[model samples]
Target: MIFSRITEVLTHVGVITLLILLAVTLVYYPEFRLVVFLTFIMVITLTVYISRRAARKPPKLFDVIADEVRRGSILFEVDDDEVSRLLEKDFTLYEEFRKQSYKALLESVIIVPIFLWYFIYFYLILPRFVITDLNLRLIAYIIGFVVPYILYLASELVFRVKTLTYVLRGYEVYDRGIVSSSQYIVIKFPLSKDYLVREYSNRKCVELSRKHGRYTVRFLLYTKNTPKLTETLSNYGKAEVISS
Candidate 1:
């Protein structure tokens, strides 16, 4: 009993000491990191509080994935009204939206810090280094711009699960399956159509794949004509389950 109490007291003391040190650092240097740290804590606290406040949230996942896949997987076409109906026809829409929101949160959490780091290095510290090192200025600027670009790309690539292209205009999801997935990549789109295209930007046929473990999704963006859209595939997602 005495040992347990001592251990508990020590743990509390250690945590308090660490927090005090962190507060001191923040007070000394009110930098981006400190602000980001505080922001992250607020977000985490909000997420936990909101999640805990609600109970019996219902089975909303399967419905969403199913509806989105079905709506977006069609090869033919759909009108705006029909699309609305499809989206609202079932409970899946709500769940799919939740899924999207979750994806957004994951992205936001990741991006906030990377952006802070960029601000610190480029806007804050890099100038000091470059002022003394004439040879390093060009490289520094290049690296500064490129590093953030890379981080932005990486964050998007990592968290782009809902990155779907409005291919086939109004076509719907006939089927879906896991073509492939990974940390930096994920491809998921309608399996019914052979090709999905985004015409507004350019003409390209992009194969879609959901990201691994629900982090992000990736679709191969390419261009092709309607005649080539005849090809088809079986089984969109692995172990395809019927959702609400």
Candidate 2:
């Protein structure tokens, strides 16, 4: 397992390293950069395909839940809509949480500088680097701008699709447990009385505590109907609301 994970990490790093190298090379050799641009597209397409395949693979937690379900141990199941709603709520809360973090500030610092560098290098320096006809240089400039933007849009699309797939999975609240998964489960745990239900960013979240671990599951954003879900969970176990 460790070896496979290492291999996957290396594969991703290698792809990124190659792309960076190609981008740098484009600065010096703008003539044949179109070919490099096409190669970049191909690489990105393959990466997205591989990522989607990996996403479909069942997580280890699913195996444990399958065994339990086979033994008729599951008591109740939550619909996919409820799971998705909760996940969306959590995503919003997480975004708000992230915005307040030092890491977010650091990311902005790093990303903004890199973007500025790319714009200056490609738009100004790259055109000057071109030792060819004005028309060809114009084409190079267009390719330089379009390729990166296309890559960025494609990457965002992949991320959104992956997140959507994850949250759309049906969840099961077993006789004594719950499994979090859409297609492949990643978490399964027994319910604990020490759990807390709280509101954060106008969303409901339940923090489940077990003998040796804790997991927090988020629910829908606060609305007129939010109390219904909270009331249902409260009926099953101890629940308390605290500040975000």
Candidate 3:
């Protein structure tokens, strides 16, 4: 229940911070602050819903990988009841995927707008302010503009290079308790994201089951996760890997 507990803590913190901000706004900018706060609340709700839905249906990349890993006939072709069993244990995995997708999508969508706003505010608005109030440092303005752009680019790169799906199971995403040496390798979904090279198109993937004593990934350099790879290796037991 760590996830539920942490979720509660974060929700509490966010709510409290929002309340404080609202109180400050009421005191400092009573004219239009309430309207802005209402807009913020609406936007936040919409974003959370859209993100949760998108997480349920990741772009083709994760779709392909999840399909392969979840529906693969080799290990996944289980009885209907057994399939349900696999889905037991946790709902946090799905939530984790949803949160990451939301963050990445938000980053992608915000980059351009953020850049444009910065250019307009600093170059047009700030200079006008400087003309009226002589305390504006030109050097500081230049640094601020450059720093934000650099940060935006870096964030974009990080998102592009990061994993589409991340999972934390039992106690941790990498938790390896006495789950019994699974006949089908119950890899907790996120068991090996740092080194997995699965694709995202909900494509079919081959599973290992001592079938000829080998396991493998059929593609190379597909999606981002921590440790990126360009190809599958001859041995997967020793090397880390996972599907979306």
Candidate 4:
């Protein structure tokens, strides 16, 4: 865990350093800005493309659940039979959710905007601004402000959609508790804790209280066996069904 945190910190530092260098180059060496800009765009585009492609291919279900169990520090014993049963029931559904989530993230939030910014700035705005026409320069400035604002809104909308989809469909029940995944984020709520299980309409949700506060979370997919699941959860804490 320490190594992982250190690696994350180093990665952030590297990215910030690169951004500062790129900015300095743009300011002091205008002649090379186009080359640098194109290179950066190409790198981002390729990285996003590769990442999306890789995310579409999920690992074996047993491996995924095993990794999560270890990461969550789950104390209850889980054998191969239990793991296989869980996988047998939810593997296909989990795969489908993952694909949709990652696709939404890549196209709506990452790759499309990179290409859009490249086209808008490099091909359109930059060339016009270079001519030094007052009216055209004003238009360029307006576009510079507006485009990113619009992209920000779009990105947020897509992020919310992806987040909701992930939260609703992606969770697994183990002997200890429930494990959920959202893209790279994983959260586990052990049944031994202060928790509540509630059902509304077709959805079943869990609320876990931590040092910070209570978090009410809904599962990503609906199951017909919600009553059974709720009964199992009640063994750990308060569990009930609520009217819609």
By TM-score, who's the top model here?
4
The best candidate by lDDT is 2
Off by over 4 Å in 3: 1-85, 129-145, 157-161, 164-244
Could you give candidate 1's per-residue lDDT for residues 1-244 as a string of tens digits? 3554475456445543443444344434547546745653564345434332221122121223333344444443323444344444435335766887887677657656755775697568965652544345545544543455355545655555534322222333244422111212222443323232222112223334343232233333222332223233323332222111
Ranking by TM-score: 4, 2, 3, 1
Q: In candidate 4, which residue pairs clash?
A: 168-219, 168-220, 168-221, 169-220, 169-221
Say which prediction, candidate 2 or candidate 4, comes out ahead on lDDT. 2
Over 4 Å off, model 4 = 1-17, 30-34, 46-110, 130-190, 200-229, 235-244
- Report the backbone clash tally of model 2: 1
Task: Note the Cα lDDT for every prediction shown.
Answer: 0.41, 0.49, 0.38, 0.46
Model 1 worst lDDT window (10 residues): 177-186
In candidate 1, stretches whose alpha carbon ends up further than 4 angstroms from where it belongs are: 1-96, 106-115, 127-131, 161-244
Q: How close is candidate 1 to the true structure, as a TM-score?
A: 0.29
Ranking by lDDT, best first?
2, 4, 1, 3
Candidate 2, 121-240: lDDT as tens digits: 666787577456655654565565445544543543433221111232565554333454544443333324544455443554433322221122333223324455354445443355
Better of 1 and 2 by lDDT: 2
lDDT of 4 by residue, 90-207 (tens): 5554786788668665565554664677567756767764645555554554454345534643554454332222333345555444554433323343432433344432433333
lDDT for 139 in candidate 4 is: 51
Q: Candidate 3 versus the native: TM-score? A: 0.30
**lDDT over C-alpha atoms for residue 133 of model 3:** 26
